[model samples]
Target: MAYLDPRPANPAEALTELLAGNERFVNGTRVHPHQDAEHRAAVATAQRPFAVVFGCSDSRLAAEIIFDRGLGDLFVVRTAGHIVGVEVTASLEYGVTVLGAPLVVVLGHDSCGAIQATHAAMTGTRLPGRELGAIAERVTPSIWQANARQITDYDEVGMIHVRRTVENLTRPGTELGDAVAAGRCDVVGMFYRLADGRVSVLAAESAGE
Candidate 1:
């Protein structure tokens, strides 16, 4: 038997679905969608994930669980601080170009250890090893940006990092950027509130009419 997915076809529709799922999560009335056995078998050979969720590797930032989505609902990519690099960019591009995902979401969270460490590193309090330092370097700009605005909060820095990540993805000349320019997809940055279980949209970049 064949199964069909009712996932959204365009970027705007995909964003709406994600927002609705988040609402269900916040209300604690989550009816987790698309996790049944039949759904699993249907997607074994092919997947039609609607959105590409690029988020942090933090334990609490589970994309499917937090968004109330289930099997084959999202193509997820995660890294510490959700940093961008060649691999990360290539993976996200594959999700949009090859998998036909319409939406790419950059998910960040409050009280993030990465942001905290970056801030501490900038303030001369923490010096991470070479490997971890690379991650800190990627997140350093947001810390600097926050400090420029006299913001001392780590959550504010984390939000800035999220927006920066989305901007990096959609910047001119990149594959994702070209796609967005051509009206093929959208990139959104969001902050997840650890205490409230809510995801707030920070920035959305797409081809404008």
Candidate 2:
């Protein structure tokens, strides 16, 4: 894969590549592509990752391992609840604009501690650590949204949060949004199943619209 010419020329192709890799992982037929020492050295000077994955920081959500991709295949961003703060937004912007990635994946998983903590906080529990509490605070809106819809299950709440994150990233006027609007990128919301090691698409924008 040449750094100058990226593979999976379109968003659909990029998304397909990730899905195929995840299938390999799920079937335990992982090829672990691009991780050889030679490929690692080849990408050291430059990287042209095809997708930018913004997913929860859960241990089981390790992007490369689960996606079965090796070096320079994905530019990954992580937060406790996969929160999209300024830094996360900027990093993804760079991945798309600077790195020229075609696809952005927003992944959330089941049994997320951040979701649980946010739910607890909503139920009147006092969180101890200031920074940790702040993380929960960011996730509070999703909890509220779920509650408004009478959805109390943590995994369901996680799906709502992931969908919200996808909406926020692709909303009008943002850098990511502009890219999508111009037919330069595609944003997909995905939910990961820890039990089965599978991924399901929750939301997606086709061809930027």
Candidate 3:
């Protein structure tokens, strides 16, 4: 079967689709679109997803489930704390620059263990391993940014990290940055409430700055 995805015209409609899906999820009326065998096979040949969701790797934060998207709707990338490292940067560039996705979402949530550990380490508790320490190191700047505003809570810090992440990807000279500069893409930072199943925008960088 030829799966026909009339791509969103721009970032605004792309975001609307995501928010509407989350509303469906929150209201327990998920349609669960595009999971059939034909859709899977169609996407296997070529995927033109509308958005790239770079989120925390928490089990409860499944992008498709929470956003009510199915195969080929989203190009999803994830990391603990949703860190934007070299690999992640490349993946996002692939999604927007190559696949032509118009929107990039940085999704973070409350009660995140990664943000919690970063907070603990900031408070002088040592991270258990070299890799874990590196993760904390990447998260340090966000906590410091939060501290400048007197915010010490993990969820608040996570929001700060997500916002910082959006800024990084949309700032000048990066791949996503170029895309945004040329009015081809937008980057948005979003926060998810684990208990309420709601996602809200924290910060955004639309096309042309």
Candidate 4:
């Protein structure tokens, strides 16, 4: 049987599809045989990715594998801790506004080195250069806030960062924000576990919920 395209009219269905894909992956029942040369040729003509992903640059957390999706299925942007910088935001805007992706997932992962580095900096432990320090600086506020709340677990820190990135992207007047408010796109946050390969969504108000 052909797989049903899970591009629902609302974002919730998009998210559900992603979650179900992850479950399939964990259960070792992924269905991506179409990623071969024949499928690649077919997709060469045009692409209609259903979702936009902003995720950490971790090697183990590739969006396609985790979500059990094939080529031309996702527009993905990766950076450390999935931080929302100018270039990243611009890429996501293009995906939402031009590519017509219905959902945007800001994905963080367990034991993220970025979050750990930020925590180290917030605790006044030295990290190397100005370049590395800049990343820590960008993520420090979230770590500090999480720390203040007595939450020290790395998973929680990563989740907090994901939530902050989502909030930053969804603020009013921004292109992503406008897309979300107009119901043209949705921004959701999730956490990926490196050990078990499970994804836990962070936002309570998921699109179409």
For each candidate in turn, the TM-score is 0.94, 0.93, 0.94, 0.90
lDDT per residue as tens, model 2, 1-209: 34533478889999899999999999999998888878877788888899999999898899999999988999999999999789999999999999999999999999999999877777777553777887887898888888888999999999989988998888899999999999999999999999999999885434432
**Model 4 misplaced stretches (Cα beyond 4 Å):** 1-9, 204-209
Q: For each candidate, what is the lDDT?
A: 0.89, 0.89, 0.89, 0.83
List pairs with backbone clashes in candidate 2.
none
Order of candidate numbers by TM-score, starting with the best: 1, 3, 2, 4
TM-score of predicted model 3?
A: 0.94
Q: Put down candidate 3 lDDT per residue, 104-123, tens digits, no spaces.
A: 99999999888888778877
Task: Compose the digit string of candidate 4's lDDT tens values, residues 41-159.
Answer: 76777766788989999999899999998877889999987876789889999988898888999999988999888777767786636888778878988887687778988888788
The true-versus-predicted C-alpha distance at residue 27 of model 3, in Å, is: 0.4
Off by over 4 Å in 3: 204-209
Residues 1-209, candidate 1: write the lDDT tens digits: 45466779899999999989999999999998888887888889887789999999999999999999988889999999999999999999999999999999999999899988877787789897889999999998878777787878888778878988988898899999999999999998889999889998885434440
